[model samples]
Each structure stands twice: as C-alpha cells, then as structure tokens.
Target chain A: MSEEHAVPAARLRTRGLHLAYGDASIIEDMNLCFPDAQVTAIVGPNGCGKSTLLAGLARLHAPRGGAVLLDGKDIHRLPTREVARRVALLPQDTQAPEGMTVSELIRFGRQPHQGWLRQWSDEDRDIVAHALAVADLQQLAQRSLDSMSGGQRQRAWIAMAIAQQTPLLLLDEPTSALDLGHQLEVFELIRRQAHTGTTVIMVVHDLASACRFADNLVAMHAGRVIAQGPPDRIITPELIRELYGVECTLLADPVTGTPILAGVRRA
Target chain B: MTNAGSTRAGLGVTFCGAGIALAIVCLASLLIGAGNTGADLALATLLGQSSNEEARFVVYELRLPRMLMGLAAGAALGVAGALLQAVTRNPLAEPGLLGVSAGSGLAVAIAIALGSSATTLRISVAQLGALAGCLCVLAAARTRGVGSDPIRLVLAGAAFSGLLFALTSLLLLLDQRTADEIRFWLVGSIAGRSMDQVTAILPSMALAAVLILLVIRSLAALALGERTAVGLGHRPELVRLTVVVAVALLVGATTAVAGPIAFIGLVVPFAARALAGSDIRRALWLCLPLGPLTVIGADILSRVVVQPSELPLGVLTAMLGAPVLVAVVRANRLPSL
Candidate 1:
C-alpha cells in the first residue's frame, strides 16, 4: 500500500469493443479503462474472454463492432509501428529461437525504433542495457535463453518487454508455468516495472497473487465484466461463487494487508 | 557487457575464417579438374607465369566459369535455405526437399519439352516455377496440423516434389528430340555452362538480395513467434510474403544455372547455424561463405573422383548433404528455430 501514486491517465480504453472468433463471440460490448502507470490484473475463470480482451488491447485481435482507443484515436487506425512504440505485450506462449542469447532476444524489442539504415545505435544499446539491469539480468546477458532456469528465462522475457520502453505493458499469464519462487521473481519484477510509471496490465490466473500484486482487478465471467475495482472492495463470497463456483473466506495478509482468499469450497 | 563484446569479436573471427576457407575452396575449384592440367599448371596460368595453352583454356573457359557459377549458385541456395527455415520456423524446410528446386526443374523441363533453348527464357521460367513452389510450401506450412509439425510439412513437400519429378520424367519420355538435353540437364551438373548463363540470373539475385536486406531484421523478429513479432511493430504477414518471394527468386535462379543442385541448401545453412547459432542475421552471414565452400568443395571432389568422366555437381552435393540431413534428423531433438 506504500507504493507512490502517479497522476492516473486513461490512455488506453475500450468503447463497446466486440471481439469474436468467426461466429463465436468471445467478448461483446466490453467497455473498460486501463489506468496509466498502474498495475491492473484481469482475472477470471476458464473461457471468460480475459485473454481475448488483452489481445484486443494489444491490437492482435481486431474489434468486431467498436474500437480500442489509444490516446483518443482508434488503435486499429494508427500505424502499427506507432502503436507498438506506445504499447508492448508479452503473450502467454513466448518462444525464442534456439541458441538465442538473452541480450540478443532483448535487442528485438528495439526493432520498432530502428530502421534499415539506423541499426544498433548507441541509444538502442543503452536502453537494452537498462532493461537488463532493471530485470536483474545483467549477468545473463550473454547466456542463451535455453540455458537459463525457469525464473531466469521468464525474467529475460520480461527484460525484452522492458527494453521496448513502452508506457503500457500487457502480459498474459506471465507466471503460469513457474514455481512459487519463480512466480514471486516475476511478480516483483512486474511491480518494479509498474513503480517506474509504466502501465502494467496482465491476465493473471491466481486470484490470491492477483490480489497481492494488482492495484486494481477486473473480474469477468462469460465475456462480461462482473466486477471491477480494487481487490478489497470488489472481492466477496458471492463474487467468488459467481466467477469460480467456489465459496471462500476473505482473509488479510498479516504484513501487506492485501486481501487473501482462504478456506475455499466448491459452491 | 564484456561477454557480448567478446561474442561479437568471436563472430567476426568466425566469419573471416569461413571467408578464408571459401577462398581456398574457390582456388581449389579453379586448380583441380578432370583434365590433363594439374593444380600447379593452373596456378601458374592464373598467375600469368606459364603460357600453357591447354591449362589456360581449361582454367579460363571451363574451370573459371564453373567455379563462378558454383559460388553464385551455392550462395543463393544457402541463403535461400536459411531464409526458408527462418520463415517457416522449421529446420527441415529446404528448397530441394520442399519441392522448390523440383518446381523450377519441372518448369525448365517443360520449357525444354516445348523446344525452347533460350537461356534467358529458361531462367525466367525456372523462377516462376520456384515462386509457385515456394507458395505451395508456405501454404502447407499454414495448414492446421501440418504447419505445427515440421516433419509433416516436409512430408507434404516430399510428396509434392515426387509428383513434380514424375511429371518431368513423363515429359522427357514423350519428347524424344529434347530427351537428351533434358536428361543431361536433369542430372544436374555445372560443367560446360558459360559465364553468360550466370550473368543472366544476376539481376533477379540482386533484387532478392535487396529484399532480404530490407526484411532481415523483421525475419529475425519472426523467429520469436508471430504474435510477439506483431507486438514488436512488425507486420508478420508482410515479412512472410517477402521472405517467400525472396526464397523463390534465389532458389529459382540457382536451379536455372545449376540444374537443381540438392542438399547444398540443406547442408550449408545447417553448418552455418552450427557455427553461428540461430540468430538469422548471424547465421545468414555465415551461410554466404559456408554455402560457396560446400558447393565448390563438392565440385572439386566431383572433378577428381571420376577423372575422365566427371561426377555431376548435383550428385556430389546430394552425396554430401544426405548424411548431414540424416544426422540432423537422428539428433536427440530437432533444434527449434
């Protein structure tokens, strides 16, 4: 709760965004505002369209009826590279070419800012170095991604996103496959990134971790936002039952004072 | 930071070493041959020391042009292989194996069957065939289950190649007058080909080179999966289309001159990736040298192996490349691109 707050600006927002895969509508008439320089987590159960919304926000998925606005203009209408400069996304399935060093992978983040004639500038080098440091991966810069452990590999991926230096970062289940320690390693890194005034939006699977890490939570079910606010204000037994069909007691973290779900049972 | 610098320096050293090796191979290609002229005589002729007329003719007219063609064809096939593998994200995706070479070969066979002997027209026909083949391979790669499985995609390509080769053979059977020419060309050799044929395809190769330079960075981004590439501000569709066209041009040009040399495309990029790792930019640089080295080395071996009757350049490359292909497939795991 002691994290310093920046003047929040809703640079990214959806106006009646409708997304579908052919005839199957995933997210319909979705309206949401993602606060700048803050960490917001989208948490929902299976088939809830959280990832679809993330894709729409990142412009990977086109809106069916409405629009995703970036800085008051339709995101789809802006030049791709121009949108890329302002937003970066780390999708759930991240794979790098074999034998790619951490630094080489991170250097890809600077592609948007580079051109055919202007490659590997001093500025690009500096930003990559800064990203490595920020992700605590300086020592592993030359190490291949395949050689690293799970936590270190995830950090390297995060470092690549950091090197983009975009104001908004969206991650889909960044800690999905990692162990608890590695999960913390990534969550802390995301927190540090948010502290530096980058808007961090991620689709998190674990409600407890989402409550602990995200400043705001958007809970969804069947392509609808059932609840949206701070975790402490929006989380309740009824909301938990609605989202996951589980009834649980909400407890408080002893030190951080964040909401923690305990004693859960199937509704 | 220092580690990165050291790696960069190491790459430079490796690149220079490959370049020197390619130069040696080029020299060997020029020196050793199936004729009466020996390496010493060819060297003397090259240095303008001896006026041996036979050595001069063999070196200048026969060996020199063949070596140049080998270099150009080798580089093109090597680069084409690397580009194909990178874009398809499949290590086994090769010009020869994936029907691209066969595509061009069939085009030329069709041309030869129709009684067309013009060199420029043949090159254009071959390129057009290569473009078609390239599109077919990409289409197979985009299919639901086939695209995700590298081996399945290769299987599809092999089937397509077999069909094309059968069609080419059928054409040869139907046309007896063009049969000898088509048969000789079908075996794939660089002997007796002139410098003019090599020069004819230069414009297309040059254009392909320009396209590659433009998309090299984007292609590298593509190796990280499509969504990530899109997230990085690159148009993955555009990059894929450009790479397919570039691969077609390179493979088509090489086939036009070399009669569908196989396995150099596969082996050269494999070795380059081994030496330079998987970064396409670095692997591509190594491919430039390694490709020519492999082709020229094979060409030299082909000359000395059979003496009076030289081995076909295509046959020699297949002999060399097939084992590497087996080795790669037999490895514990196919290295993911």
Candidate 2:
C-alpha cells in the first residue's frame, strides 16, 4: 500500500482518516494530500466514498480516526468561521432558499467577516464587488437564484464559493446537474480560479473531464485508493476496470492532449 | 414595461391591503372589549376623565397594557419565527415548533410548582427555558447525519417539545397550586394579563433584539447550506448556537408574558410571505404588522364569540394556524424557510 505521508501539503492535508454514517463504515484509514493552487479530482465508482471523502476533508463529517489538516494545522481544532476564511466548499446538491438573488447568495460569503457591529464595511463591499466581477455576475446580481437558467445559477453558486475567498476550495460534483455547456462554464471558472493560485479539489464522475481539467487525479475503488498521479500515468485499462468496472481503451485527446477513454469491449 | 409595472402594482396592492388590515386591527383592539366597556366609553375615558373609576381603570390601565402585550408579543414571536425559518431553511422551523416554547413552559411550570412567584419572574425564567430548548434542538440539528430534511427537523423539534411538555406536566401535577398556575398558563393565551407581565419580559426582548441584528446576515448565509456557511468563514456551529439562544430568549419571553400562545409564529410568517415574497428581510418586515394583527384579531374574536368567557389565545391561534400548516404541506413543494 502506498502511504501519502511523504506528500507535501500547500494548504490541506488528510492523515489516517476514517468515517461512518451510523452503523455503516464509509471510508477507512485513508491518507491523502491536496496541494495548493492546483486542480485535483477524485474519480471512482458510485459507492466508492468519493463524496464522503470530500465531505470529511471539508470538516462536514467528523472522522472516527485521523485528522484533516488545513494550513499544516488540524482543521478540526480551528473555529468553523476561521477555517472558512481559508477554505471554501461547494456541495454536490446545493439548495438555496427561494427568491435568493444571485448577489444575495454571493453576499453570504461575507458572513464570517460581518457581525452586528461590523455589518457594512467597505472591505466587505469591495470583496463582493470583486467576486461578482470575477464571475461575470454584475449583470445578474439582482436576479434570483430560482429565476436563473441552470448554467447561470451554477455560475452564481460558484461565484458565491469564490466570494468565500479561500485559497483552497473543495467541490463535490459541482457540475452534476448541469448540461454540457453549463458544465463547461463551471469547469472553466474552476480552472481559472486554479490558475490564479487558488487550490481546488473536486469529485467528478466523467473520466475525460477529470483528465482534461485536473493536474492531479486520485482513483479509488471500494474505499481504497487504487492509483494517484498524473492522468497519463494512471490511465491504464486495468486501473479503469478496477475503479469503474469499465473495459475501455485510453487514447490521447487530440484537442487537449489529455487522456481520453475510448472503448472496445468489456473486460 | 407594462407587465413588469403590473407585477409591481400587484405587489403594491397586496402591501396596501395588509396595511389597511393592520390599521383597522390596531384601532379595533382598543375599541372592542368583552367587559361593560365600549369604544365610545373607552374613548371618553381616554380623553381625560370618567364618572366611573371602574371604566377608567379597565380602559386606561388594564386593557391597554394587555393590548400592548398582544402587539409586542405577537410581533416578537412573528419575527422569531421568520428568522428561525429563514436560517434553518425550513418554513416549519418556528421557535414553538422547535420546542423552545415548551422549554420555557417547563421551567416556568417548575418554578410555579415550587411555590415560587411565577408571575414576578415570568420573563426571566421563561427565557432561560427557551434558551435550553433552543440549544438542544439546534445542537441536535447540527449533529452529524442530520442532513437538510425539512420534515426530520420538525420531527426532532416535536420530540424535544414533547419531552419538555412531559416535564412541565409532571411538575404541574406535583403541587395543586402549581398545577393550577401551569394549567392556566399552558393552554396558551393572552387574557386578563397585567402590565407587570409585560414589564417582566422586556429585558430579554431587548437582548433578543441585539442578537437578532447579529444573526440575520449569518442566517441568510445559512439558507445556502452548511458547507457554504462554513466556507464563507462563518462558524455554522456558532451561528446555529446564537440563533438557538436568540430564538429562545425572544420566544421564551413572549411565552412568559402571554403563556405559550401557539401558531402566531407559524401563521404570521406564512402570511408575511404571501404578502412580501421570499426575501428574508422583507418577510421579517412584513411579519411585524401581520403578527400583531393576527393576535389582536384572534384576541378580539375570542372575546366576542362567547361574550362573557374568552377563548384561549392558543386555541384561537391553532384555529388560524391549522389551515396554514395544511397549505404549507399541500403546496407543490414546501417552501424553504
């Protein structure tokens, strides 16, 4: 078994982690490191604990064993508000209260910094403005989240996560409910954020999208890491069969020169 | 341009209609009474002097305070309900729904049973109970594996309320006087209450005000969901904790003065939404008038329905609130708080 202790962390690191929901154990004895300012994707089959792992790392789920380290310190020990300043998370199934405007949703990203006394500071306003500009949300700031198209709403949510202004962002299938174009809009934004020194870790189901976007890929099967490396190194037929139970040939995508899952027959 | 104008105009009409209802209710609360007093007689007493000390005393001192109590208590309960629903992202998540009211009731019931002055310490003790109830419910909501299901949260609240009610009942049973006091209080109403009761709950109401100002922003953030709340550097746990405490203080104090008036919190917010749309700030604003109108209207109805005997405010509220609860459930989708 390859232990991840040797991997260096720029922002977030998970050490010897375990988790469960009631009687059922979801993940056990897992160790992983998410480097800063890069895109890392965890891709695995449906029941492989991919979302669980993401949630655990974000402190949404407490681990029965081990710790998730943020900024080389234990994330669990940090106040939720304090940790939020450094890391933001986008959940897979996001729900907003009806009639929540895009700007209203993004403005929530400033909650930790705001209080009864310090509610309307200039810094708060400037940051929200900056986030809107970055997400191209200035035009639709007043539009309700419920009123927007799928792609626009997804953008609005991503704008909210970005407004969190954390160096590290963890997204669990942020594109699950989006169409292809909407998916691209969100992925490109995630990529742009990554390029600008924000560390991003996402759980994606599509191997091609994962290969195209992620600089680092972690593949898991039945709650164990089967492979972790660049897409080129981990795209073998056997690895695909182990992770996805799919029998497919891997070819280089001509456009992006990333690994593409092309197929023949079953294993 | 014309279509948008009509939508805005439609909203304007709704708001104006609510305002007119509010004005009429406020004036009518002062006008209508179960006693020998009438609007003309009350007005004569209000103008300066009256031949009968009894009418003057009832009009100026007794009914006025009670009406004010209804207004303030209803207002506070409505806002508390609106805020809790907004933050929990569940429309059913009212202070009373979450057992905060029961918590206050149980504590006060115990106090009264111990031969303590229930009327004197009504506000403080009730607030303390509310705080306990609020904390327990929110802590349970925050615990792992309790994802954002609207029904489950309400269920948890029901269990919490049931536990507190059981405790209250047990305490009330222990002493006859306490049972008398608790029984009178538990039915949830605002009738024949004195100005002293209103004075007792004011400090906590003030404290709740401060907390409300602090909580609204975080609550709006919370409506997005937890991961987002945390990512925004908001301590979701801390915000939840504050919300629990604030809800308890406000609801507890209101319950203390009014004796567990039910459904104002639920129906007021529901009415506020139909009038103001879904923006939390607007919903809260509309709740201020709608809440008092409902309580005072119910209080008036309670008086007139059976001339000499008044209906419990709780009964009246339940009557008003039941249809709302049904509507909430029958909607194509339950609106998130």
Candidate 3:
C-alpha cells in the first residue's frame, strides 16, 4: 500500500504475547492490536484465554514472553503511575468497603495522581464529579454502594474507572450476572465512553451483544484468535460453530444491521 | 463536591472529639488510682499547689508513668490492630488473637530464661519475636483457602496463637525462678512499669508511626482487592509486608512496657472504625486518640472495679473485646477487611 493510504497504528498492541498460570500456558504467541477510539470485544467460549489476554494487557498478569505496548513503548517498563494514567481496568468482580459512599469509592481512582505532598485538588474534584455525572450517579453519589441496586453499583464501579480519566479502558465481563436491562445500561455507558474518543476493550461473553455494541470483534478459541474485523464481517455461522461446537445461524439485526445469532442446537 | 467537602469536615470533627475524650481520660487516669491518695489530692497536686508528699509521689511517680504507659501502649495496640485488619482484609484480625502478642510474650519468656534483664534488650527481643509472629499469621493467611475467607483466616490465627501460648507455658514450667518476671508479661498490665521501660519502647513506636504513614494510603487501596491495588500503581505485596513490620514494632513496643495487653488492638480498631467509617486511613487517624482513650479508660476502670488490688489491664480489655468479636461475627455481615 502507498504510504498515505496506510492505516494508523493501534494505541495498544501485543507483540507475540505469551501468558501462563504456573506451568499451564494459557495464551501463546498471540499478536493483536486494538486501535484507538474503538470498542473492541474479545469473545470466546469456556476455557478460552480472552480474560487472560485482557489481564495481561492491563498488567495484572505479566506475560512470559514478548511485550504489551502502550502507544509505542513497552507498558511493563513504564512507571506504574504513568501506566495507570494511560489505562484503566475494571475486572468482572470488584468490591468496595462497607459503608463507602459512591463519591468515596470514586475518589480512590485519583490515587495515581495523588501523593502525600499533594492530596485533593480542584482538578481531581472536577474529574470525579464529571465521572459521577457521566455514569448517571449524581443523585446516588452520597449513597453507600451497599444500599444501591445491582445496576447502580455496577455504574458506580464504572464511574470509578471513568474518574481515572485514562485514554484506554479495559473491562472483563462488565455486565455479567446483571439482568438484560442492567446489561444494556452498562453497555450504553461503555459505548458512550468509546464515543468520547477512549479506546475501550472488553471481554464479552454474549456474542450477539458484543457484535451489537463493539466497533470491532475478536473471536478466539482454545487460546488463539480465529477471526477479527468489524462485527458484520468477522461473525459467521461457521465461526460460531467453530468457537462453540454448536450449530447456529447468523442473522442481521433489522434495526442496527449488526450480526445476531438465531436458531442454535447441539452439533 | 460540596457534599464531599462537608463529609470530610465531619470526619475532622469526629477526630477532634476523640482527641478531647483522650485528654479527659488521661486526666482521669492521673486523678484516680487504687491508693489512699484520692482524686481530689491528685488533682490538687497537678494544679501546682503544695500538696502532701504522698499525694505528689502518687501523682508524679506512680500515676504519671502509668498514664503515659497507657497512652503509648494503647495507641500502639490500636494502630497495630487496625493495620493487621486492613492488610488481611479481615475485620476480626487482631495482634493478640493472631499470636503477635503471644509471640512477644514467648520471646520475653525466653529472654528471662536466658537471664537478659536489661530493659532495652528486652524491648528489641520482644519486637523481634512479634515480627516473627506477624509473619506467621501472614503466612497462614497466604495459604490457599485461608487468605480469601475472613473466618478461615481468623481460625488459622487462633490455631497459631494457641500453639504459641502452649510454648510459652512450657517455658514457664521449665524456669520456675523466673516465674515472677514472666508472670507479669503473660497477664498484661500497665501498673508498676518504670519510666525506663516506657522510654525503651518509645523509639520503636516512633519508627512504626513513620512506617504507617508511608503505607496507609496503599493499605486503603488494598481494600478494593490486590489486583485493584496493583492497578492503582501500588505494590500490594510490598504494602502488605510494610504493614506487617509496622504491626510487629507496635505490638512489640506495647508488650515490652505493658505486657501483651490483650484485645487493645481489636477493640481500638473496632471503635475507631465505628467512629470513623471503614477506610483504614480515617480509622487510623481516629485510632491515635481512641487508642489512648480506650486504654486509659480501661486502665482507670481496672483500678476502680477491684479496690486495693487493680485488675490486669489485659484482663479488662479481653472482657470488653471478646463480646465485640462475637458481635462482629454475628452481625450477619462482617465489614470488609
């Protein structure tokens, strides 16, 4: 391709990444790049390494080989505080101490920017307030997380990540165990975040929703990426069968034109 | 933001209230004692008036040292307890129950057996033992099933403490002549400790205070779990180790001067959290005054409850702390560590 026609490089890239728990290797020789300002979903069945890959990217799990690059440098080598300022991760399950108000929980996100010499500042306060507003938690800011509903609690957690004000956001099943309505609520927030020019990457269990919400979809099976592209182009009946070992048909959503899974049965 | 600012101000007010309570309790500790010299006489002596020799001696020599000892020991135990609970993420975690104090007791017992009577060396030896004990509890918590579950960690601690207690008893049986010296360390008390003993432990307490200030922020972040703490630019393992060292120093210093006063760590942290929410940072701030307040209150109560002969300060704290422990476990939901 001509130089001008070449696509810009992704903000986050994995160069032959390898990960393992003890002696059992999970992801091996994986190379992928998640472009900036897009919602990228990593979808797979059980025993796949989607969540593990995300953990490696977030530096929660160190890779055994190669590197995870943020912008153009190796992320592992960067100072921890600098890395936190550039990326934020929200695992599937998170907890706050008892009786901690929503505002208090969100305030913890400013830890990277805070020190003994410099505690609370106007910018920190403004960002935390902005995070609460974006998460629709302005009214519940004073309420304790324990008193909130499942949906509200989840939103509060996302608000904490939002308060970090990172350009890259990573979530592991951000809506798991929530009802359909709550799922949509969280996904809408994630979508809004992505629309604001943040690169949002999430490990999504539901392929249909992943296709519906994400700008790009990465499909993995048995620790390797099998397909990746725009959801409309990457998702197919054969790909679903290969990933899940189930017979299924793919259909386009009437309203959004995103790929949707229809009839399915055991193969 | 305005609401948050107000909430913070409310916390500041709570801390001030606790400080005032501490001052009142310290005065009470100075004024009241189990002796012929009454509170009126002690107050007269404190007011710079010419009082009888007995009253001046009682307030200056006896009550003054004891109250100062209570303040230092109380603050140490309370802060140590809070640090243990925060690092383990178990509200029930206490130095006394987790064998830290028992560890100090055993070390002192060994020291007495070895004929090391120097007060300064005893403090160091006790602190070293307490460090070992803190490490043991942490090791137990790190074991697979025990680390994550609060009750299981407590159970492991209880078991470890029982082992240390048994070893200490064995040391007592082996050395009969040193029984008098070891007896005081076993059943902790604030009485009869000279100013020299208090001075000896002050250095360790100061060191612990510095360490706590350094790690308190990271300990708060750890409440969100280890991964979240790491994600926030904190080194979770390093924070946990620093907390353990700080706990060992505090517990050792307290045990050195006042014996292994039971439950001050547990009760102090419990009360601090109650008065100032669950954040370790806030709880620790409250712990400063609340520890001395609770310890001195218990010390005064120990003197008054049994006239002519004071109860061991450790005994009173245990009586007050055990119920709170049960109440915490039975409260349907234990506060997240």
TM-score of chain B only, all predictions? 0.97, 0.89, 0.96
TM-scores for candidates 1 onward, in order: 0.97, 0.83, 0.97
Candidate 2's residue-wise lDDT over B1-337, tens digit each? 0111123465566667766887788777777788888888877777775677877887768777878888888888998888777766678877777898888998888777766775657677888888888777666666655426777787888888888888887786677877887798788877778887777777777887788767666666666776766666666666777776777888988888788887788889887876666766667767877888888899889888888777787887888787887788788988765
Model 3 lDDT per residue over A132-156, tens place: 9999999989898888888899899
* Residue ranges of candidate 3 with Cα displaced over 4 Å: A1-7, B1-6
- Which CAPRI quality tier does the interface of model 1 achieve? medium
Scored on chain A only, each candidate's TM-score is: 0.96, 0.95, 0.96
Give the candidates in order of DockQ, highest first. 1, 3, 2
Q: Of the pair 1 and 2, which is ahead by lDDT?
A: 1
Candidate 1 runs further than 4 Å off: A1-8, B1-6
Query: What is candidate 1's CA lDDT for residue B190?
Result: 78
> Which 10 residues in a row give candidate 1 chain A its minimum summed lDDT?
A1-10
lDDT of 3 at A262: 81
In Å, what is the interface RMSD of model 2? 3.5
Residue A134 accuracy (lDDT) in model 2? 83
**Clashing residue pairs, backbone N/CA/C < 3 A, model 1:** none
Least accurate 10 contiguous residues by lDDT in model 2 chain A: A1-10
